[model samples]
Target: MGPRFQNNDRARLYREIYEQHGPIAPVVLPGDVPCWLVLGYRELHQITSDPVLFSRDSQLWNRWPEIPADWPLLPMVGKQPSILYTVGERHQRRAALISDALAAVDPFELRSHSERFADRLIDELCGRGSGDLISEYAKVLPALVLAQLYGFSDEAGARLVPSINALVDGGPDALAGRDTVKSAMSTLLASRRAAPAAGVASRLLYHDYARDFSFEEILEDMMVNIVAGHQPTADWIGNSLRLMLTDDRFAASLSGGRHSVAEAMNEVLWEDTPTQNIAGRWTTRDTQLAGRHIAAGDLLMLSFAAANGDPQVRPDRGSFTGGNSAFLSFGHGEHRCPYPAQDIAEGIARTGIEVLLDRLPDVDLAVSPQALVWRPSPFLRGLASLPVRFTPTPKSTAGGSR
Candidate 1:
């Protein structure tokens, strides 16, 4: 997959891929890396469900010797001690530790943090009346809240936003961004070790299973959690808001309807999920999937966007997917996004959108929907900028505002 895969109408591209090569098609990555792109819903489900056959271990990859040190995709598919590549029983324990740490985050506090950060971000642009929501609000809000949850102070949390964004964007600064994040996480871990705090970092550092994991392992897990949590949540907010503003179906939302907010968010998950494709599962043994022959150790990319739009499952793609939580946007099976993490993401994203609409009731797209641009990254789907205009309202006071 190249930049065009993300930059162009990706839905149409998925359709073309499906028609040409069926559900599982051969494709090349940025470094001319060959892999199977699993586009069928059933095919993807089968692969994710049976992790034993399609392992998560990057070491299982057969092309590692040919992969150069500086390969751009290395950061993604590179063999690391992180949970993303972990397999078997050890992976299950790691997943549980992460889930428990995240699950401890109070839902009430989570929503409060979301609203507080949402308000702070909107406060910066409410008076301007015209601002890019992606930069001014959606992009920064989730990181700010998540950083605090992970034990960063307000200033440090604010500082983490740019680095997180750059890292997720996978641009020239991605490596540097990764380094900065690692350093910040290390410092946080050290600080938490010295003085226990009420946050996910402290929980992870002192969990019953903490002693079972090494410092580097725990640190890698934290980095994975933070990076994975921030960007996709941010994109969820951006993409959902874009849908509400552009789609006539959600026009009622702009005028103070709360019900449509959830609807639009769910719809985005099915149609324009932030995470379009994942680097993916490696075949443990040669097997036939969707009638395609795959050799042992072959790489298979999961196309969630295509799977959610699979013609066999969603024959009427245009119909409203009301309360249909069957979408594979979050993956399936053991390695899927943990339920607790999904709850946190939904809380952050939903609250962000709700607060923005409540604050700027008349907010409308500043540019034509057709003119809006998407970030040029194959892994994530989100707006480069969501420029919107609303009637200028007086800034809110710390106590209360009109």
Candidate 2:
């Protein structure tokens, strides 16, 4: 809402916000749009759990009249036919269709694709001795893998990386980036419809419930699926890599120790989650949450980072989470990220990190830990660049071992 939300020290900012305003604090977003920031772990869980009271439909927002057509946050909170805003019975069917399609992805094939992309990305920097992990590897890897799974040609997928990055960054180019992504997905859907193929796009188009929704609805769902799938997974890779390089606890991972990769990733979800806040649940009716009075149609932003850090739940905030998986980095409830989608994201992120460590056994941060910068986004948290230096090595040839 304020500069503090985009600041690098936002972890401290969340603590301050919690200390000042309790669980649900009223805050203003860009363009002076006011909403409540839900900071408590239990409060967020309760709001997500009761989708009936806290709905996903953006039309229920009370401040739509005041929100200008040119509002920067419009792209995020704007109502659409996409599954993101869908609710109840139809939403259930759509979720099932998407889940089944994604679940059909062979885990071995998924890993194989991920490893291939990861190796290719690393190869781009392997000879340079120093490169930015964010731009060269983390920022582009997930989209490439996801694009393949979604039926895009390698060339088209390669072109999609920048557009996806721009769209999520919410920069001046965001609208243009959105347009590009829409066009690309539209083309892919049309192609798949004319001649069905073995990919998620084709699966969604020919699914059992495909008849229940229009072509436009399925198109929007595909757009949401790709955009939603890409950015956070990219951030997850960048954030996890940053943690492994900066924290001594994960130092062993750089030397081919595989166990620490999972630990570092789990720790990032608890401490430095990719999705810090989400443009979230709107109250369907007047209700009380964490003792805060709420009117019908009030917006409640879900602060995943804050909830994960909530003192009530995580009493020892400074302690490592180890193998604990209770963190709310992923939203909870019926509408939370589908289990299959979560698996896909996890496979992409984990494989990317694992492949990098295996390839660059001597990699270390090129810049001082303090010199690293985080991207300026109120809703997402990720490194702007992750420069690292390692011994120069030869690039992998096609079909090389991963």
Candidate 3:
């Protein structure tokens, strides 16, 4: 029998697979589909980008048992590169709509909003000595950023946060229950119809839908964009914060103002990318990878963490320090994240971390690393709850220190 299925600790399992197989190994998953596990840096890029060998369409995984039609094992993945899942022309068109908006963003404007949200969350954490970063802070930050960007009402944005979180967690109910999100989208669309706001939704309402997309397609595209912007961005903020907290040297560097935390945030993404598993095409013909033969019709699992950690690509750094920045957490090659709208979310989260660190000089994680609970979903990696404590220095004193 092959290795037992490991849940959240994929880094461990991936390492074992690499050591045993020397990069590519024939493995049998519980579903009985034969797969060649690709772990090396070069192999991952080659297989993932080779259109002839692998198809992103899920129709290829037709024989798998765990995947139910209502609950796709991987929803809309590889089917098309529609923004996150798309490739070529479709990818370019969908990405173009949002990319310009991202490019034109004023960093100072985004930083101002992030500061406001961080202040409110800090106030909420005031009297209490500790709190769950995921619920209290990490969760609200992205929704507010996306909502403000899209011109959605505060109430509408707040309502959709949990629903988007559920969608990230993934299940049949989770997939079907996105009606809440649809309702919010419909309301926003209607409101924009009368009085358009200067956000992505409004832009989509006037630009994409009015021209290229049908009314129904506009709704569908908006629904995906809103949640896509919110979920992974939020997850990354939380994960990166936890990582920084565990390594004080890195956190201090960010807070110290010596390095550009804005740029370092990209490295944080490369180090521990929020999303874990990405589904792609099955090879239509026999292919050689890392010197092993992968037969046609075999599915492959792409592990970003494994690729990011590959020594061949990333240089050896001592003890997870704060300065190393070349990580694959942001993804690379054809499917790399577009980071539209100025890569706003990561900037916001970085600002929050910097502000928090500056104010609470003594703040640190309150529990052991092993005790921390990672969300069970294998597709993304993040802490379920990050409890932290800090010395409550007076704002006046904190300001003076800064």
Candidate 4:
């Protein structure tokens, strides 16, 4: 099996593959799923920037006949019929609608809500003196922010995290998770259609594209947005917290030395990309990329993690200041994530992490950082848990006592 599916030391494995196999290396994931990992900075730029040769729609795959019906990678690579999976004019239309709905959210309110959610989480955990920072804190914060964006109450946000985790996890239980998410989303879609509340979902309903959507379409779109919105932000917060607790040089920057929260977030984005590998491209015909032969219909994923660590990428760059495009964490080309608004992933991630660190200044990993476990998913990267400890403090008044 390729190093992609291995739960431990994934960044080192990708670098090893790059040294052995050059820019574009072929690797087999679990279930014997075969695909190419684009491992170089230059190679990824070319593939992502050029869409005609690499179709985002897996429906264009000529190799599906060879793939197993129970293919475990469906949740990642299979066609989900959303803006995320489409290309050209079809992608533009739906992407615009999602962007418009996202823009409707007030940025000040979004920032305020994220800070409030982060502060509230600290309030619950600060008295404990110890907790699994992953499940108890970082992982749950973004879902709460997303809950507000979707027009659902903040309490309802916690309920959707499990389903999102299931959808991304390449385990046997994932299908059941997908089903639960579908059922819940369908109910949400129905409620929005009937009552029309004031949130992203309600805004989406009135859009020309969604106005004619069937129940299944509405469910699929909603599911895609929730996963797209929450997963990376959670991963960002989780990865950042792990680095702050484990790496001294990195942690120093966060503790009032060099980097701001935005700088630290960009550093993590460039160094240890949250969404490690994403497979959307299907080779339309035989083509050679960066000296490697890519056959028609072969699946291809951009190794965002590997590309960031590529020799050409400046390992020291900490901020997205100026015009630097050194990271491909959010991807490139027309298919770049549509919801770039403040109330979306990045805003929630920055606001939440900054508040948590300020309120819990003494937080440190309870377990050896090396002892932490990772979920065994080939397409994504995150810790299984981050056990941490700090001196218990009374409820924080500085965080507005939220």
RMSD of each: 1.7, 1.4, 4.1, 3.1
> Mind giving the per-residue lDDT tens digits that candidate 1 earns over 73-119?
88778888899999999888889999999999998889888888888
Error of 1 at 50 (Å): 0.8
Stretches > 4 Å off in candidate 2: 1-4, 397-401
Q: List the residue pairs that clash in candidate 1.
A: none
**Sorted on lDDT, highest at the top, how do the candidates line up?**
1, 2, 4, 3
In model 4, what is the error at residue 385, expressed in angstroms? 1.2
lDDT tens readout by residue for model 3, 1-402:
222223335666767777788666676544454556666777777766665566554545544565445443436343532455445565556566656545555677677767766666676785577778888888777777677667776676666777776765675557554777777777877888789877777777666524665555666767766666666777777877776666555565535663645544555566667766565557777777777767666777776777766656654623443455555555555555666632776677777777666655566788986677777654676677889887664433332122
Residue-wise C-alpha lDDT for candidate 2, range 220-300, written one tens digit per residue? 888888888888898999999999998999999988888999999999999989888888999989988888889999999
Sum up the clashes in candidate 2: 0
| Model 3: CA > 4 A from native | 1-10, 27-30, 60-87, 171-177, 193-195, 208-210, 251-267, 314-326, 392-402
**TM-scores for every predicted model:** 0.97, 0.97, 0.83, 0.89
Q: What is the C-alpha local distance difference test score of each model? A: 0.89, 0.89, 0.64, 0.75
lDDT value for candidate 3? 0.64
In candidate 1, which residue ranges exceed 4 Å CA deviation? 1-4, 398-402
lDDT value, candidate 1, whole model: 0.89
Writing each residue's lDDT as its tens digit, candidate 4 over 1-402 gives 344445556766777888899878887766767788898888888888888898897887766777777676666777777666777776777777778888888878788888888888888989989988778777777777777778777656677777667665645767787787777777777799899988888888888887555666656777777776777778788887787677665566446443555666776777667788888688889999888888998888888888887855654434343234457888887777664642367778877777777777777889886688776666667788888888888776764333
